[model samples]
Target: MKFQLDEQQGGNAISRHDGQCVWVNGQPHRASLLVPWRGEVQPWPLSRFEDLTEAHFEQILACKPELVVFGSGARIRFARPQLYRSLIQARIGVETMDLGAACRTYNVLASEGRAVLAALLIDPE
Candidate 1:
């Protein structure tokens, strides 16, 4: 689906998302990715939820976001707290949801100028 928000809001907001792909600032991205409120949109190297590792969460620390929205593919699946213990230690909040919801939530927080990141997992086609 597509999303509408003021372009002037000034942040890396999710512009569209569907079963197959996600668009960041109108650029289509088919792989899993990281969308920060403001900064580069990173490609997350995770293709399956089951393959998640602690190092995945650790990599996010470089962005130092206040919160992270984890999109666990097409369904809402929670990762074990231990996998993200690093984030907990850093006091960064993490929320898990289906891919679509994560996109929407990330957009809202990004538009509000919150330091948020969307760590989305998209299975390879």
Candidate 2:
């Protein structure tokens, strides 16, 4: 479940070494136990929010991921205090890293059969 990404046809594509699944951006090629983009892929999960708003909290709760990796596109940022607390309450671990690092982390964790969710944003230009 090591995922290698490719820039194909002007969009991002994901390829996994173990052939478990493939995704373009966050959309899975087939229905998977892991749901990508359960919410809007941009501001909600990918970015560091000011607070754990109801919608954001609900989305993460629904995912029930053992770990949630936030790819802040190109930088690392701390989560809002409320958001951090909510995740802790849900017994989920959180990692905030740059997009590339987040991607790598997600692949490794997913390969280990951990329920992992990633929110990555791609620079359009």
| Per-prediction TM-score to the true structure, in the order listed | 0.92, 0.58
Please provide, for model 1 over 6-33, each residue's C-alpha lDDT reduced to its tens digit, 9 standing for 90 to 100.
5726688677888679999899999989
- In the order shown, what is each candidate's alpha-carbon RMSD? 2.6, 8.7
TM-score (C-alpha) between model 2 and the true structure: 0.58
Write the residue-wise lDDT of candidate 2 on 1-125 in tens digits: 82443332332334431122335455653211222323233234322333335556556667677787765444565656575576788888878886667766766665555667775543321
lDDT of 1: 0.89
Off by over 4 Å in 1: 1-4
Pairs clashing within candidate 1: none
Clashing pairs in 2: none
Could you tell me which 10 consecutive residues in candidate 1 have the lowest summed lDDT? 1-10
